[model samples]
Target chain A: MFDQLVAKLPVGICVVDEQYRLQYLNAFFLDRMRPDQRHNYLQQPLISIFPEQAKFLTRRIKSVFVLQHPSFSYWEQRAHIFPFKSSRPITGEETQMYQNMEIVPISGPSSEQKLACIILQDVTAQASYLMAQQELASALKQEHTAQRKLIKKLDSAQSQLIQAEKMASTGQLAAGIAHEINNPIGFVTANLATLKDYSEQLLNLCDALADKLQVTSPSLAQFSAQTMDTYHYELLKEDISPLVDESCEGLNRVRDIVENLKQFALEESTGWQLFNLHETTQQLVKLVGAQYKAPVYKVSCNPPNLQIFCEPASIKQALTNILINAAQSIKCKGFVKIDIRATAQRVSIKVIDSGVGISAENIKKIFDPFFTTKPEGMGQGLGLSVAYTAIEKHKGKIIANSNPGRGTVVEILVPVVHPEQRHECAEPLGGS
Target chain B: MSTESVLTADQRDALQELMNISMGQAANSLAHLIETKIGISIPKIASVTPEQLFSMISEQADAYYTRQSFLGDIQGEVMSVVSQQGLCEVGALLEYDAPLSQTDIQEIILELSNILAGACLAGLSAQLALGTNLNMPTLFSPRKANFEEFQWSNSLVMEVQFDIEISSFSMRVVFCLDDASLDRLTQTLDELLG
Candidate 1:
């Protein structure tokens, strides 16, 4: 009955004695091994049957005999020992079966030899689940890179806007100064005209006197005419014309500088409007970049009138910051491109520049307060710090993608807020 | 001094008595089911290594090995040696019919080890008034170990043999403790004996 039961077993049953020879191979074992080896391998050593795993099995089998302890190995460490084809050849996911083995020392009067037993279990499903999790982690790492660049651009625009604000205020002051200077120059010029008329009258009277002398007293006329000419005409005319021209020229230079400053610092209405994304992008690029002469700025928002509802002032500030950063990143003329995409739910503004990309170590600190890559006095390093502040206020997200020496791209997303949702003067940023 | 010296003679006797009572209960659980007379050799316990075990059971050349471990107030493993002869009859008595496949035989051994080892440990702990936990049963081969390479000294071992009076069935369960645990076991046994 025991012999019959061994033949009827579901799994392969093979027992090897201490000498490592096959003491018994049940029907299950015969059904799996090489057909010729199945018959011949009987009573033969297991090593001669499978030569590839010979060294590994030999060490393990010997340990079992030496320690007199049960030893086990699973598919987790070594998946395939005997490369038996999957029991389900047609529909199985695995080509080779995963196996587990056990070794034991059997003691009895008739058989004092030790035996080794092997069991196999399939585990394809669990392995695949673990692989899927790794893929997700890698994808997250990629998305995180993209988010950083947009934040950088926002920071730059903000800093540029601050500069623009200073320039604009200075421009306003220049205009006021021009008005105040004009007040005093008005009377000065009019009085100078009247004094020239009086001087002409006095010259006429002197001329008349000189004629009278010429007729009455020829000697007196000669003396008087010479004296008057020495004191008057040629000297006065020489001094006046050049002084007037120079005063006019100096005032004009001051006016021109003030105009440029005002343009740099232009402020718009605080409310939302359907502003043309393309036009605003151009204006922002021009405005911020006008002060920073470093990087080349390019604008491409095709269908130029791509309109979106946003506070134009803030949008300009955001873009200007990005463009300025692009400008600073380039040692020579490098391109900075502004792209605006309008959709039903939001607007995406991308500022891509061929600037020095942020380094990995510094990228983490980019959003940190007062972190700057600029030389002292050039910047307070509040650029990206402020950018992060603005993006958060707008319920938007900005990201950066940078490759050192290659370029950096900042992507900004502005949610389409309904009329009621927009807040004015809600603080530019909560101080990043 | 020696790890064994901690166990006084009186404490050792008490521990042996506790083992005899637990083994008696374990044998009864099997004997009542098989409807056969069951006999247990005076209970002997030992501290042994895999190599030491190989020689101890040299008489049962073709026998199967099954071990179950328990832990709680005290922790130890119950290793059973089943003689290859007439095991099928005992397997049948355990509700596993004859025509036994290798796996079926293994399954019966593990199940038998679980019930007997679990119950015996429970009884032993109760006799000592200590709580314990029993782990799962696992099969092993003792002859695979190299005795020469083994570094353990001749251990303080208390050994026992159990025999099934009917159906040619016989087995043994050896409870081995580490040296530190042996000392603790002696102290607990002394307290109980007192």
Candidate 2:
């Protein structure tokens, strides 16, 4: 009964001698072997029977004999040390069996002769299940990374869309306001001119009347002189001309501001064209200087007539907005300098202002739409944002640096050739 | 119950002496197999709370850990702390290639733990005239395990250290026995003492 129990055990059992000759095979092992080998496999070398794993099996069996202790081999290190098919080949994920083997030394009657028993256990289901779980976890990690990247991209695109919508609507509103203000400015300017001429004529007529009355009638002259004294006519005669001239100048300024508004709102007129950077900078400084006379405006260009192909209207608008900010930043005597330089493929413009510089935190949001630190009704906060949008259209870059108490410097870089014309220019240069 | 009262001073001394002989035999077996000299320290026997056990074993920063259990006459576990330093030299002694892969390193660690832990348990069981079988050893991480909710509050712990003379390699083997095993062990020590 004991022998039958050992023979019918579920595990694979094989006994080998010192020379690695198979001495016995249990029923579990014999049933898995070929019909001829099952009947006549006794006393055969273990290596000859299973030559594929002979080297590894022999080494392990030798260790057991030498140490006289049990030696173990796990499936994690060496999965299949035997050439056995899976018990359930059809339903299992793996066709080859995964086995964990153990070798133990046994004595045969006398301690002088040593024998080793090999026990193999199938563990295919456990290993395959664990591997599948690991693969799924790694796949999940990759998907998480890809999703985070997509969310970041979506956030930037949404912000850009919001900025574009605000710019379009603001541009339209500015155009409408400019058009409405244009009519009032025109009539006010015409009326101021006529009033100045009329006041001048009336003053001259009074001077002529005073001289004639003095000569024609002494008594009448005395009356006239008294009336003139009572009215302070000499002071009036001197201040009237200056008052009218100041009014006319003030009206002209209002008209110029309106004209600037119209130019800034010319959204449809923006088109790629060859523009002179030097001339534009000079014009911008002169215009902004007239409004904020406290700051001294200086302009310079390396090549006096350096030209670039770009949207002339928007480029001018962007520079105008930047110059206005520089000029306004100064409360007292300071200098605002514009330096333009042209390289082979690009132009660089630097606007340096000796004014109360922006704080570090404020500089970051200077280009954000509707962000401003100015007092109410002093600024609309759209100036820098508009400039940012215009330059971005041309694929140019703008950067600002400032020291709180010192000053601020704004730098801009624009490509000399438009992207559409870049190909055309490259071909000629290559040929030459 | 107090852990010191579990065994008398005479019993503790006898058990310590028994562990010394068994641990020395384990070191000798390893030396014989590797053809190198190995040194062993005297075994220390104590009763410790789970918290003390966690602190004592988890303090080594650069070490590999393995745990194996044994059953039959007494039920207990063997926890080994193998220093990472000079592991490459130990791998060389195990007939592994110079540049060891992950599988090769794991196999070496498992194999070493098996040979040493198995020999020590076998020697001790033989001296006590008890039958015991050691289960397979597996890699363990003390940091990952939660010790606060451990089932056992206190255990009888036996500790020993082995150092390979040719390299800077050292490993600490700790055996923890349950309450029933502790009782069985002290009773057997009493019989030997009588």
Candidate 3:
């Protein structure tokens, strides 16, 4: 009964003697062998029947016999040790069988008759499943990394949108205040000019009367001189004209500043236009230099008087914000250099400052809206963020490089003509 | 001190001789399996506190560790420490291919521990006419704090080192017997001396 059970087992089992001669083969092993060699295989060496893996097989069998312990071989290391086809070759995906073999030492009735038993199990399906799982895990990991990068980009874009909204509201408020101030400035200038004319005409009439009185009546002349001395008319006459002129000059200055404010806030003509970039940069330097007198401002433009097609106000505003930041960074004395280099394709504006530089930790957050190192209420921390948005609208890039206690250099690059504008320009020419 | 005095000098000497013979057999089995000459140091026997045992085993760095327990006439655990250096060469000797994977290295460590520990236990049991069964081996990493918290104060430990001639591969096998097993082992040594 035991012999019958061993012959019918599903796993392939075979026993070999100390010299590796085949002693026994169960039905499972015999069914896969050639019928002609089956009868003679009992007394032959195990390697003679399976010569493909002869080296590995011999080593394993010898090890089991000598060590008196089992030795294992998996499909991962050596796929197939025997010349066998898959059990379900007709339906299975694998063309050849994957196997795991175990060799254990067995003792016969006599001490000299030591033998080793070989057990082979098919594990094709399990190995295939594990490999598929590993491939899927790696694919998921790659997708997770890509999604993390996309999320970071979206986070930055959201903050930029918020900063743009804040600037829009501020611009609207300035526009309203500029319109109200223009009404009062118009009448104040006209009334001051009329009052100056009236006073000058009355003083001329008094001067003629005094001359007539001196010539016609000597007694009346004495009385007139006494009255002039009593009223201090000479001092009044000297100070009156100069005071009116100074008041008018002050009013004109106020009007010029309000006009600049209106132009800065105006959104009309936001479209692209050909601009003299050199003139714009020089004006910016003059404007900021007047306010911050300590910093020595210098402007250098290569290929002098280069022109670019961009929104004039926005470009001026972006440069203005950067210049202000540079000026404020100086504690005592420093210089702010605006270097404008223009190529046929793009314009590069580098604002270099010799002032207190930004710290490493704060540099990364500088572009983020509302991220400020300044004391509360001193700054809204929207200067760089606004500049960033303006540059982005023109499809440009802005970068800042700084060394603490040394200085900071901000580089801005804007294409001379945007890609969409280039396409539009080519369309009309093509049609013609 | 109490645990130290339990074994007489004659009994200690007799046990050491018996351990030497068993360790030789263990090394011989591995040498024959790998077709290479193997050398072993003289076996050392001592009664040690838990702290001493932990220090003795955990001091070696860059080594793979494994433990297997045995049952029957005596109960004890066997711990094996194999150096990580030159393990690829040793794996080749055991019929494993070059550039061993992590799994392949793990399997090699377990099998090597089982063979040496099993043979040593078998040789010792055969000499004393006692039956012993060894459980499967598993990887072990000991922490000093955990070992110091062990309930057993002292144990009798037997240690031996095996060195392969062709390779820099070396391993140390430490056998620790329980309190009752230690008494049984001493009695068995005395009987052998008689």
Candidate 4:
């Protein structure tokens, strides 16, 4: 019964003598040994049985016997102590059995003699489970990153939707107001024309009155007639015409702002055209230079007559976001240098700012969406990432270099798309 | 009371004598095993802010850094800065494979830091008759240390560099003691001086 019980245990058990020789092994261990090994393993050295770990294991085993202390060998730091296959050769899922081993010294009565007993545990299932868990955790991490990206994109789309909704309602309000103004404008313009003709007749009558007043040569009567006649002519030709012109200018300014607002709200642009790069750069500089402080902006182009076919509106928004970032990076009076170079296949634009720069550690992660170092409400951290996406849409690359207290430089290389190659970005297919 | 003021020259002299003996013992232990001549510089003791501490480490190239924090009745970290120059040669002398990866280099650094720092602290503490617990060593990036980000400002530092002459490898081991431990260390040194 005891033998059967010993045999029933799953793993092979072995005990070695002080001299690194395998002196005893359980029935299970004996049975699992190869047919060739079983014939010769009796009273054989442990090294002979396991050839791979011979040198290291022998040295370790010597330490246990010498120190007369219990020693442990963990599969945690180094698993697979012995490369033995699983017992279930035909049906077992396991290819290799993970092992943990511990060695304890058994002292004999002689001062010179000692013995060490070694125990091995099969940890295949635990190792595989741990590996699977590690893989699962890593996969979850990757999925989490992907999910965060999707959520950021969703959030941007949501903000755009909200802004577009507001603009749409505002446009409706403007159209309504325009409708009201148009009716008044039509009649007022007609009335002004009629008024002008009336004023012309009145002025003619006044001129005749002035001329007649001058010829009569009666001082008091001529003075009263001339003062009244001059007043009528002055109202028509001198003051009223200029007032109308000034009002026209004021209305035109409002109309221009509303038109620009409409253009900015548009999600799509129908036509792509070859645009002057220098003119676009100047327009962008003017747009941001009016708003930000603490930084002076300078622009230089290598080739003046360079042009690129692009959606000018989207590209302009991208530039505006970046310039704003550069301006904000500076704490004190700092210089922002913009260098543009046109190559055969692409245009390279570099925006550099002398400001509080990024640290080396944070540089790698800056391109990740929503990873911002700016203080609360100063930035959403989405600007550079959005710029990245827009440039990527044009099959371009952007890089950032910075050192603390020195400055930051962002370089962008955009492939100059030809007119034939300009295509609108396709919307994501699924609503999700 | 002066808030992390360093020891005076006489105090430094007494502390240096204690360190010299302990460092010698540690070097003897390493030399016995590696069979190579190792040299230790006299301890240059100072009270430093954490920023100066980081700059002290970041200036070395082919050099990797590791830090081990010890806690007992007192607590602080021991930073071991090891140079990469002739490391493969030294690694060969120590029986590691050539052309190490960063992680392999890191593992080697951890092992070396554990051994040397463990010996150094044990020797120093044994001489002063104080108890100190040495923790596991981990690789550190010196340049990434933003000292302003740390809560603690001043530290009592005992810094020394050891060079193995058989090979061109050099390593600097620094001991940073907290305020309470500084008091303990100075008292212990005073007792040894007496």
Best by DockQ: 2
lDDT of 4 by residue, A1-432 (tens): 976775566765666777788866666666756778876676789988888777546755764554333444545544666767765567767786677666666654565566676667788778877888999999999999999999988987675455445545665675566556656666765666677677667767867766776777669556866677766745556776667666666555445444443344342442466767676676566546656766888999889756778766556656766788888888779988888898788899899999899999998977766779978887666677667766786778989999889999989899767775444333333443
lDDT by residue (B30-110, candidate 4, tens digit) is 666566888999977777777787777777867888888888855788999998887887676556566776644665666
Candidate 1 chain A weakest ten by summed lDDT: A423-432
DockQ of predictions, in order shown: 0.02, 0.37, 0.26, 0.04
Whichever of 2 and 4 has more DockQ, that candidate is 2
Question: What's the ranking of the predictions by TM-score, best on top?
Answer: 2, 3, 4, 1
lDDT of 4 at A170: 62
Ranking by lDDT: 2, 3, 4, 1
Give the per-residue lDDT digits (tens) of candidate 2, residues A1-432: 977998988888899999999988898788778788888788899989888877568767876776677888898988888888887878877888888888888887687889999998888888788789989999999999999989986765566556556665776797798899889888988887898888889889888998999899999889989999899999998998899888888888777766665655554644566777786677566657767999988999998887888777678878988999999889999999999998887889999999999999999999876677899888767778778877887778999999987899999897678646854433333532
In angstroms, the error of model 2 at A260 is 3.9
Q: Docking quality tier of candidate 4? A: incorrect
lDDT string, candidate 3, A165-269, tens digits: 666677778879989999999999999999899879878877888999999999998899899889888887888899999999989977876766666566554
Error of 1 at A425 (Å): 37
The docking category that best describes candidate 1 is incorrect
Question: For model 2, what is the error of residue A359's alpha carbon versus the real structure, in angstroms, after optimal superposition?
Answer: 17
Residue B123's C-alpha lDDT in candidate 1?
A: 72
True-contact fraction per candidate equals: 0.00, 0.38, 0.34, 0.00
Clashing pairs in 4: B62-B84
Question: What is the lDDT, from 0 to 100, of the residue A253 in candidate 4?
Answer: 48
